[model samples]
Target: MTCMQLLLYSYPYVTRFDLRRLMGQKIKLTKSTIDKLPIPQMGARVDYFDTDCKGFGIRVSSNSRRFFVLKRVKGKLTRVMLKPYGVITPEQARVEANKAISKLYDGIDINAEKAKDNLKGMTLADALKKYFETKTLKPRTVENYGDLFRLYLDDWLHKPISGITKEMVATRHLNISNQNRKAAANNVMRTLRAVYNFANELHDDTLPPNPVKRLSNTGQWNKIERRQTVIPAKQLPQVFQAIQKLENPVIRDYILLLLFTGARRREMACLRWESVDLEAKIFTLMVTKNGKPLILPMSNFIYDIFNKRKALRENDYVFPGHGKTEHLIDSRKQVNAITQITAVEFTLHDLRRTFASNISGTVVGGYELKRLLNHSFGNDDVTAGYVIHSIEKLRIIMQEATDHLLMLCTAGKKINE
Candidate 1:
């Protein structure tokens, strides 16, 4: 038997010193000693300890040799790699080993200390960049977050996230609210809260509690009511007449489609020809705000609009634009023009509200209305889960609603004539 094997057999409970001696010769680990050490066989390693410094050693393996420091940390022996043999001289390794041993004796966790340092150094901008990298947010949501930071938190970008205090958050919220941008203030705080919470979770909870929580605790958050604006049914004809006179055919059709389908502006604006079915008399939205695809039966008016757009199709988009997206974006100028001419003040979303308000009780049931709007039933509405409204049924309801709207428009046109 080999001498090392016999020694292992004799001493069942071998100490690290005994193991080190069995593995390699005990010597002062100078550059000369490290260079003279024999490399172990393939798949084997030999650890040579320095007699001059306790727990300082050089590990020789088939591949390479590296310097390391060994210490008992929290009752467990831990070996921390310092540098490869050629990367640092023997004197440099000794200096690093001494520092490492000192830290271990002081009960300082090197890894934990580094993590804390990183957390402390992270700025709001850095946190935001990391948040975007780690999250799977929709493009529009990402863009909106960027816009919020630029508009509201631009000054705070370079500020360390850990340094932001509860008092600072409260003061900022109050100041933004006083500027009459109550909704913007709430949105900014919410965005900051999301980013801070994400960072706190990411850094092993080493960060302080989110400062944005201060707004809620101190009742400093703005109380902005949801807008309930919608076009009065009587004014539908005026709005329609003004929309028809729009010079830009694309914008004119886009606004009409929004009113006809009760679709969000972006949803209708970004429609593709592939999603529209001329024969089926239906249109489908593959990407809706709720993340669910919507297939809605087109009313006669909506079908006609799509047919007209099909004839004028210049690209894949139903309403093609000259921009990078190759789809219609905003039509605020045209909408504002209609509002001015008809004296009917309304936003694009207001048309969506108008469509729902006009047709809710008269044309469809509660669940049917919700389905038409592509809204989630939510967990609270258990009965809604059981209720399934088919496309044909929805088509009938849509037709009835479209007929009513057309009747109003016709009446308004006759009055104007």
Candidate 2:
């Protein structure tokens, strides 16, 4: 016989419940049997158990009734709530109870095992909730993480976080890479790595080391090429004319600001009116990709674009969203329209790269261009520490690049000279 059968044979007198009877047997607590039990008139829950089912019990109060399993280990009582009445039937509760009883008789503390199961219960979905609560992340970053989870780990989300294995991650990486979405595959693993990192911190002793760590050792990561596309000097004029002809004034100015400032799409997207100081010819960014404050001097042409936007100064955002958020996020439609009009076939970052290429070696030296672009070269460069470009100095360099770009674009036709 099993430990459950052995326990039921021994614990006959421990059940003192004079609960309603079920045929000739010790009333197996069910919906019908539970309804027959007396309501505890003192505003406390009344419990009833089946003599045949060792750990099963039905707890009833005036407001609610629940099924629970009670396991006694080392003379201490442990209770685990199975579910509400209609949620799980009496037969289901008994099945769960017998399982708990089997664990208890095997020299195991049901409470401790349940606690271990709780850590084991930490699903990827639950881990994400904990991660969002604990980590300070950018709003866009948090959204992207969720998208990664939904896209890649939809099947794994409900599984226990601890149950994720290295082999599983490896298979996923290979499968995703096969679809030709190399960057997305790499990003999905990186995002899961962050989730596992958070799990390690939260469940210090319980969670296994992150499974995604094997990707680097196994050489599973995809190689992504950095794009070096730029607008050739001759094509820029026609591109400018196409931008000016487009309808949305906001989009027209936004494209011009990006080309002129070389700012990231998100930085420009989340721009606030307070960050721009037209009089000082400077723009202050509170947050950058590197977590540093980047203050860029607005070119005279970019300053003019801001000057016309002053009429719509009632809102706090430079680009207002149609939704609850203040800033505009949907720039793809406008960008595609501009691309069709100009046939430039460029992304926002391409414009930023075009700015870097236009001025990097010509208008300014390589080191000064790094400062203007807000790129961090490692501290090993002793000469770099000493070289600092002021806003006024950068303003001059920026103006040179803007003048060169606009002069090429506004030339009306391609100037070979």
Candidate 3:
């Protein structure tokens, strides 16, 4: 008998084996061959990272690591890896594997994906967020824009951009006018036009056209009555004397710079030390209402103020706040205090208007004035329209205006003995 025949009679698990028979001769079995045969045993349990299974399985070992794999009743294979001896207990692995197997039996796949549907709409709030991201506006400007949006357009923020019509915009104008008749309607119209254009760009051809183009208004409702806070042009000397009387060096220099340069209140208030170029004698307008970078050559008066500021400059801000890192954010209260004590009724903002008005009468034209004051230049339909203005002409006009202010300041000064 062959080795298979000998083992088959003794072994219970052996079922069948094929062997060639010699012609009319019986095959002989080797005892050593039959004794050397080994058989596989029943399946073992698996425990890995809270994984547990029971079936005909595999015991896998790699680099001192051990794991188990088994076929489930659903004709799918599952793996239960034994946690490293110390890092995680085999008991934890067994628990996790049992949970996974239960989920598999229930036909729930955690990795399965379901289709989702989302709505699309261009809204005022969405437009505002985009504006904040792309627009290079001054900090105060950004703050003011947020304020206007909150105070005036909070309800409209949720309204779809496409739904806003020219009629609605006109109605908003009338509404704002009734509340503050003296408000600058031109500014409101301009802001609205800009916002619509912004929304149009963002909508990417979805918005048919800018609706503000269809709207028309004379912008007469925005007329603001000018406040007479400045001393008469002839009495500029008295104003200079009043400024010099202020004891605080920061306040004194700030006031002098304002009067000399004719920069807006917040421009002076928020001016950083880096923005000032002592060598070039220019203050670069990186942030302005008009959103343009302007280089303003310093006048002698402004240069002197810068000299004084440099001597006392302890912080990065030209006008340092008390125990704060940035410049003095609000000088309105201080300006108000000075006006009250001096019996002057004009606000700090009025000073800017005064500067523009006072300089307009001289050789300074509209464009030069706009560049200096950072005012927006309008086209054919707007007042204070300026075009094709260059900095060279502005430099000359600014230098003359500053010199005039400086002469006024020094005329009444006491001679040091």
**Per-model tally of clashing residue pairs:** 0, 1, 14
Candidate 3, 361-391: lDDT as tens digits: 6747766776687776656635545255555
lDDT of 1 by residue, 127-182 (tens): 99999999999899999999999898889999988888998888888888889999
lDDT of 2 by residue, 190-217 (tens): 9999888887666665677789988998
Q: What is residue 395's positional error in candidate 1, in angstroms? A: 1.3
- What's the residue-level lDDT of 102 in candidate 2? 79
- The alpha-carbon RMSD values of the candidates against the true structure, listed in the order shown, are 7.5, 10.2, 17.5
Residue range with the least summed lDDT across 10 consecutive positions in model 2? 16-25
lDDT head-to-head 1 vs 2, winner: 1
Which candidate, 1 or 3, has the higher lDDT?
A: 1
Query: How far is 243's C-alpha from truth in model 3 (Å)?
Result: 2.5
Kindly indicate the candidate among 1 and 3 with the higher TM-score: 1
Question: Which pairs, if any, clash in model 1?
Answer: none
